[model samples]
Target: MTFEYAPAPESARVDIAPSYGLFIDGEFREASDGTAFPTVSPASEEVLADVARAGAEDVDAAVRAARAAFGPWSALPGTERAKYLFRIARLVQERSRELAVLETMDNGKPIRESRDTDLPQVAAHFFYYAGWADKLRHAGFGPDPRPVGVAGQVIPWNFPLLMLAWKVAPALAAGNTVVLKPAETTPLSALFFADICRQAQLPPGVVNIVTGDGRTGAELVAHPGIDKVAFTGSTEVGREIARTVAGTGKRLTLELGGKAANIVFDDAPLDQAVEGIVNGIFFNQGHVCCAGSRLLVQESVQEELLDALKRRMSTLRVGDPLDKNTDVGAINSAEQLARIRALAEAGEAEGAERWAPECELPSSGYWFAPTLFTGVTQAHRIAREEIFGPVLSVLTFRTPEEAVAKANNSPYGLSAGIWTEKGSRILWAASRLRAGVVWANTFNRFDPASPFGGYKESGYGREGGRHGLEAYLAGPDDRPGERHGEEEDGRAS
Candidate 1:
């Protein structure tokens, strides 16, 4: 017997302006050319706001503003900076409900995830970095590290605010100023964050946000004044950014695409592994960069596991983003929806059997049902490429050696998961996996103190914990008066 769930929609009336301007130097202003684009809700295709489309000149202006503020911001005592960060963290918690509602509307994620997962993490990142602001000497880089000057950050639409916090918090804590670009499709949260900066009394130009598409991001990265670059997006775009910044003396960090594998061994807890598989690929409608889209199961228990997995997925509710009961929401955009459709078609064309539970979809929104592809081989396009949707490709492996080999066979290696009852087996598989982040039995778990990133084509460098601070910091030698070349008396030069 099944029971129906009552619709519990959160109030959609958040205070969003009908129009938004570029946030530069702690003030909102129109783009230099006054060009603007409308950002629509992916769920209803309704134009939420006409956001300014920042041009090259706007990007230049933002960089100049960041450059201007860098000296003052970087000169502030770490303790002072910590106070500002702490204020921002408190403000974020205070406004989390509004921000979460705004995020769900703008980015097409379920309200629960935006409220429970993303919002908490966003605040935690700020609080975590705040604790380290005055304690950098203990972080082991050096006794007195210096800021890296202006940072040019470009974050993708998925996890918009969380990504912003990831890039911005550490940069500020390390005494660096930043000019950030949020993805075109979801720029409201960042703009709202600009208000947060204002509310926290963060000094002008300390954190600047320019919202636009790829062209604007390119300009920010290639700007002559930028001292560091941080981007989280597709691998293709990452490579292009790498080429743009090469030989330019800019420190670059990228957290790009992934096709992570979730391996379930025969000895694994079947029920727990099934839940992990669901959350691994279905969370955020599988828009996550480190999502485990490929399921590598032991051949011995493949049928039983598949049955359990299908039964679990059948219960997932896919509907309105504002609904508290919705398990999956709309796709981020029509373009992303089309791409997911094309890839699913390709999977079928390549002879993989596809299955999706019977669920009615809303007629107005951009949506795709949670789907699974079985009888998938390693050579299939579904298994090789990053689908970036709520689509799972299942493949069976006969042995642990084969599972490890198959898991590492991708061009991407951001994260991987191993579900086994034996601790030795978990360690053995984790040691062999090429992923940057590995989970023994759980998936999609994150902490501000744990460094998260990937290897290979998945991109380089880490983005959390004490290690993340190094990206925006200069070593002792890089700081002239603090600790440079040794003096004859064996003191700081």
Candidate 2:
């Protein structure tokens, strides 16, 4: 006998304005050119809202607002800043359900994730940074650490609200004003967050949000008034931003791309390892930057692990993002869907054995079934490129040394996972791994107090905890400006 889950869609209603203007200072205004673009629901390809597209003139205005607001905002007592952050945290929690529904509609992520994971973490980040706001002197940065001033921040669509929380909470706590540009595809949640700022009675210009595509972000980053730039997105864009800001006296931090690995040893518990592997790659439809897309299993247990992983993958439900039972939701955009499809095709072209569950997808929205490729090699495109979709690549290793070698073979060093019961083996593998954050036994965990970022091509500057404060705080020898954040690596809880 088999049991089926009934459609359990969230019934909450969120009021999204048909047209939204840029949130500058304390009010919303039309773009300089008065142009707007439609933001669509990836789940159904439905046009949700017409959002104002920020141009060069609009970006300059936002930077100017942030620049003007920085003086009073930075001069506020740490305790006062703490009050505002705490208020924002409370406001987030108060309207979390509404935000969760909005997130599901706009971002095409499961309601379960938006409600259970992203919203909670968003509030927690603000609360965590609030605690640090009044205690910055004790954070080990310096006795009088100064704000970086007028931060120009760009965030991705994967975890829209959460990424905003990660960037905005810290910058505000460190006493910096911000001009934030949410990704083109998922700007509704960020725009709603602008409303949350108003509800919290946050000061005008302290958290300006400009909604638009990559051109808007580039304009904001290049603006002369922006003292610092913080961005989370593709590595290709990150490299370009690095070059754009080099020697320009602007402090810059980038949290970019990754293609992480999840290693399973011979003695690992089969069921537990399978679960970890599933969570590592399939969470958020594998939109996470630190997703463990590569699986390196010990040769002795490769066949057994493959069997278990396939069984688990067969059970994942792919459907509406708002459905409570949906495990994997739509890909964020049609462009991203094309990329995933291309990479999966490349895996086949490269002689990798591809497998997926017998899952029927919704007819409308952009979707890709959860997939895994076996017989994969480090030289394959699927193994090296960041697919950014719910696709896993499996490879085998004969020894621990080989597993580490294969795991570290990628240019990305954001995150990696090790599964084994032995404490010593976990330690040995973790110590030798070149990734920034290594998970043992479990995967895809996060917390507000822990620092997250990557090494090498994965980009740099830590976000969260005390180390995160360093990015926004001026150095001892520095005058008043600097830049920071994670590559969205697996985290604390």
Candidate 3:
């Protein structure tokens, strides 16, 4: 008999205000248009709070505020700036439990993940960048690097607070002021972070949070005052942002979607490989941009691997996001749930064999069972598309060369994984994998010190470590003692 664990829910310890407003210039104020929208809990369909919607005018105000704060902020000694980041990091750690519970409620991710992975990484990212703040000269980005003025950043809902840290920490470390927009579905943590800024006593306008939909993001990115733009979301939106900033000469970075391949060699340790596959695809309800949705197994061991994977998948607990024992949680929103359902339906229509464990879903909120598909081919929609859900497509490959070819066939180059005990073979396979981040014996691992990004359509511009600092700084040509005259078309010489 299977042991059913009793429900252990985390208490809602955070004090969320009934209404939230746009955080601009270190102050929380209502949108100029007085428009507000409700943010709901995906696990219970409960309305959490009313968030002010930032319109174009609000975006402009945020940009202006960031622009005004840039000079004094950039002029501060890097060590002084580092102190603020360190303080923020400490504050994050101090209030991690509150943030974790808030994130779980806001994002519909398992409480275990919000507490263990999300919150810790959020704090660590700030801590990692804090050290780099005072050491820019030795960071290999030329001598005495200068901050780019105001930056506009847009983050998605899948990993809200963590993504905020990924974008905001490095930008501040490099002495650039920022105007940030959290996804409409998950805006509370960003607002809470604004409070952290107040607690840290950070200078006004160093970090600003705007809450709204795509229109708000569009205005923020296209604002003439923004010196840089960083986005993390769908490939389609990333392309639009790229186009919007093309002729404006704004520095842009995008960390977009992926349909990563988790390749299992015949000689791999079966038990560990199955665990890796589960963690790779199902973590955060598979809302991750670098989720390993495609499983490429050697033909010789395909049946064995699939059997093990299915058995393991059957044990996953899917339920309340606040439950500490829940392995998978609710879909982020109704719209996202509909998209996942459509893509999953396409997988079945294309003749892939769909299989799912018999598990009960909460009736009221958005929920999708962990699913897997067999008899999948590279041409199958399930194999080719990014179904940002808890779904896996299993495809077979005969040799390492074929495995490499099949894995690299997708438009995304974000992440990939290989499971094998052979050192030489692992190195060879990793060398040929087109992904930005490759894991030989593990999957879905992240660190603040490692630079992460993608090639091709998955987007570009590395984030994290010393490389991330470059995204917020001016190039050598624009720095003091390195200013070259402008060309005929106003391009830097």
Candidate 4:
């Protein structure tokens, strides 16, 4: 007998206002030009709320507010800053249920993921950074490191609240005020975060949130008043921001795209390797930037692994974001679905064997079944490009050296995973892999204390752990007469 799960939906406990405005200087206010756009639920195509669109004028206002708050905020003792972060972290935990449901509604990810993965991480990030506030001197940057004034942060929609936490928590803990802009497709949770700030009674202008499309991000990055810019998004947009901030004396950090590889060795445990492959690619409907989109398996185990993988894929449930039993939900938007479809078609045209499980999809919402292309070579478009959806490309390698070579062949060096029982081989392969983060016998694992970022085109600078604090701080050399390698006589030794 086949087991079936009862329909379990989370309660809609969070109240979303019909419309939302910019959160600047500790208040919700309208855009100066009165421009607004509607945000819709990707699962049902229902309009969730109309959010104000920030233009140049509003970006300028947010920057000015952050600049104004910088002196008083940065002057506050480190212990006081730690108190504010602690409050924010506690409040996030208290409101996890409401935020999780809202995230499922707006972002079209499964309720289970929102509750289990996203919300917990969001709260933990704040809690971890809160501890670092009073311990900066011991962090090894400098004895008297200073805040870099205001930070302009722009985050993507894949993990809206989590990304916001990653950006805002460290910036605030380092004594820097922030002007953040959530992605155009999803802004509800960030607005709700503004309410959390109010409940914590965080001082005005310490954390400002602006909502809009790419133009708003461009404006925020280009604003002369912003002392630092941190962004997480596509490589195309990252390049644009890099050019915009060039020669402007602004500190910049980017967490961009990736096409990570998940390699399975013949000596590995077959069952666990299959599970890792599934989790690495299908989690969050494959919207993750560090997703293991490319699968490189040893030729000896290729047939056995493929059979097991297909059998596992057949059992995955795809539908309703609110359903607790669902494994995959709707795509984030219609445009993204189109891109996935086009790339899948290209894969077929390039003579690769394409396969998708026989899963039913809702008629009204944007949906794509979990897909995989086999017999893919390095020259295939599907293998080279980032599909950014629930799609996987399969290739084969003969040895550990070949696996490492194929994995590092891509322009992106964000993340990669190795599956084997040999301890020495794991260490050797990890040393050779060009990615910033590598996992052995596991995939997609993250921690608040572990620094996460990428090498090469996947973008620069770390986002978590001790390294994250440096992005928001000014080193001793930034001050007059405190230059490194300088003698007391004010000349280089």
Candidate 5:
């Protein structure tokens, strides 16, 4: 059977180029090594654009640009710099539809998520940090806080624009200049973000976007000029980055992998719990670092919750990413699909019973049926590793303590969800859970006012709120009287 996709709002609305190059020093330039890579649409496996493959030399140029802009950009009164961030945020809003469409086309996420969740959050992140400019002096690092000289940031492909905003906004807000590398699989959104910076007329070197694969990211991270490196990706890569930068005096923060446990008690609200579980593990086809892939149900309610979960999973719509009605979309790339498949296979081999929602996945694009594995013991591979797909592993716990024990068993402490009617149980589980972000009676929720990060292998440092600004900060000498962990509360923007 052949299926046709409706045109994306911006796919037909904008003028897209045949090729995109690295954005450095306020211009588009080819990779220094003259290498190029093809970016394909995960929704259809069609070649979308040829992006420059940056090498070490290109990384140098981008870092140099960022370092050059640091003085003037850092010297600018915080309010003025804030204005540029605001301008970029406004541009993002103005072109939200185009950005959203292009995002879905290349990134393989639902258009609705690209439109509502990713795009809005991207804009809001900038806007949130925009207000933080100039306010940092009043921010609790003391009377004054100095900007870190140059930041090197590498973001994942899962949530392209949002991750860009996560890197850019906080860096700009805290007064640091940045050289950022977007994931090779989804470089289009970063190029568009660079265009918005150009439109905002932000200073020539304040932000530079270099496009490439792992090698490029490694170059950006290990560059001597970068005073700090902030990264969002897999735990393995994050560890390698940490090792490379060890003892270099370069500050670092990593938001890495996760195998979060979403626990539901017997007395919890079933309907809301079901929705949270669906959004937790299935949203974005469960590609999120903080995704809740492990489900821990109180033993008494195991059968009831499993029934509702399967029933709800069956209703999910998986197909073209451009469709506004899509509930689950294409897997990000072929390699990722293979990894998810391997993990799913491991689950079966480990004696877990796996089931998929009855839906037809696309033939051309990378696809995985929304999957769930029941009868999953703690020892099962599905419950232990990060599958990073719309696959969940269900386990049962005899008590709240057992739930907390099981939840904290994983080395990755990114995030977790708790569904319980008992206030004491909610507080207990939240406090005991090793994850950084605890969703009490909720799941997969993000806000500019909240802090998001992980505890152990999931990585460190918080993004969002005042804590998020710390990544861009330098020594205490910049602020003569600042104390660590003391927030400058009650100050207006």
Candidate 6:
């Protein structure tokens, strides 16, 4: 069946504002060259609106404006900064539905996820960090912490608005100004977010949105005025960014790629483990950065778990993102769909048995049938690479030590899931795993009050909780405008 993008208002859901232009210095304006790109609805491959394609000149101007705002914004008392974040959070909550519709339209995530998970988490992010604004001292900082100036934030297409919250909220609450360039693929919701900021009466230039692809992101990163760069993207790009800003005094925090493992011990509750394993790999079509794409099951329960997983996968609904019953949604873009298809082909070519749920995919829009591969080994490309799609690699192991070895084998160690009945084993796994977050008996659970980031090549720095504030602040006795978050430890409960 061909896909259609039924307007949110036509369905009596909500009305979304058409978003365009480069938001800079608190003004929504056209790109420097007046060039525009059509933003596509992933559900229908239809043009949603003409979006600004920020040129290098626009990026420079945005960075300058952010730098200018940084002095005053950074000097504002933490209490005042906290209030601004509070105001923005309230505004986001007020316009949640509109934003949710736009998010689903652009990102191809089900309306359920965009509304229930993404929007709520985005707001709660601000709410969580807003309270931390005046409590920096208790956050292990000095009595008064200074803000880093002019943060250059480049967020990924996956979870665009939530990434905005991850990047913008703590920066604002810690008294820093930002020049944010969202992923070119899913720029709509963030543009709408700029409008909400205007309504919140946030100081002009405190937060700016420059829309463009990786080229625009490069410009923002290389801009001389930017004091720091925070990025959430692929590991390849993160490496390049690290190299580009190597010699500069600029600070960098990267949340990069992942090929996380979901380990199922023989003693685990089979029913719960099966459910957790399914959700870990297939939720959001497996677009999550911390997706448990690698399944390591103990040999004792491997066959039983595999049968349960196939049944669970068959129940997922793959259809219109707006449908109330939809569980899996469209692939975000044709390019992403192609990537997923290509990787799945590779998995088969490399000697894995590929299996996709028996479901029809819409023809016109980008879509991939949920896929899984059994008989996978560490040598399989599917097991080693971050497919970033609804593809799971199944592997079996014998002991806890072997499971840990397999889980940590990936160069990417972002997050891991452990399913076990023994509390001691759970604690041992959590402690031994190099991942930033460990879920025991649960998978893919997120709370705004939690600090999230990865270890090693998966990237550095945290994005939530009190730990997030450290990335944006300086101790009171530090040098003028110097960053003091280098010593910030991750101790979030």
lDDT of 3 by residue, 333-444 (tens): 9999999999999999999999999999999889999999998888998888899999999999999999999999999999999999899999999999999999988998
Q: List model 4 lDDT by residue over 1-493, tens digit each.
A: 4466787777667788999999999999999999999999999999999999999999988877776677678878889999999999999999999999999999999999999999999999999999999988888789888887788999998999999999999999989889999999999999999999999999998899999999999999998777789999999999999999998888899999999999999999989998999999999999999999999999999999999999999888999989999999889999999999999999999999999998889988889999989989999988988888999999999989999999999999999999999999999999999999999999999998999999989999999899889888888667421222324332222
Of the two candidates 3 and 6, the one with more favorable TM-score, higher being better, is 3
* TM-score, predicted candidate 1 vs. hidden true structure: 0.97
- For each candidate in turn, the TM-score is 0.97, 0.97, 0.97, 0.96, 0.94, 0.94
Deviation of model 6 at 193, angstroms: 0.5
Reference-based lDDT, residue 380, model 6:
86
Measured on C-alpha atoms, candidate 2 has an lDDT of 0.90
Q: What tens digits encode model 1's per-residue C-alpha lDDT throughout 1-493?
A: 6668999999756888889999999999999999999999999999999999999899988877877777677878899999999999999999999999999999999999999999999999999999999998888788888887788999999999999999999999999888999999999999999999999999999999999899999999998778899999999999999999999878999999999999999999999999999999999999999998999999999999999999998999999999999999999999999999999999999999999998899999899999999999999999999999999999999989999999999999999999999999999999999999999889999999999999999999999999999889898677422222323321222
- Among these predictions, the greatest lDDT belongs to 1
- Please write out the lDDT profile of model 2 over residues 165-282, one tens digit for every residue: 9999989999999999999999999889898899989988899999999899989888777778899999999999999898888888888899998999999998999999999999
Off by over 4 Å in 4: 479-493
Off by over 4 Å in 2: 481-493
Q: Residue 49 deviation, candidate 5, in Å?
A: 0.4
Winner of 1 and 6 under TM-score:
1
Local distance difference test scores for all models: 0.93, 0.90, 0.91, 0.91, 0.87, 0.86
Q: Write the per-residue lDDT of candidate 5 for residues 195-226, one digit (tens) a residue.
A: 99999999888899999999999999998888
Regions of candidate 3 where Cα sits further than 4 Å from its true position:
479-493
| Regions of model 5 farther than 4 Å from truth | 1-12, 476-493
Clashing pairs in 1: none
Per-residue lDDT for 151 in model 2? 85
Q: Deviation in angstroms for 27 in model 6?
A: 1.2
Q: What tens-digit string does per-residue lDDT give for candidate 6 at 1-493? A: 4254443421525554454899998999999899888889888998888888999999988876776677677667888888888888999899888788778888988888888899999999998888988777788766767776778999999899999999899888887888999999999888888888898888888899999888899999988777789999999999999999998878899999999999999999999998898789778889999999999999999989988988888888888888766888888888888988898999999889988878988878888888889889998889998999999999999989999999999899899999988999999999999999999999989987888999999999988888787777766766433432221121111
* Residue-pair clash count for candidate 6: 0
Model 6 clash pairs are: none
Worst 10 residues of 3 by lDDT: 480-489
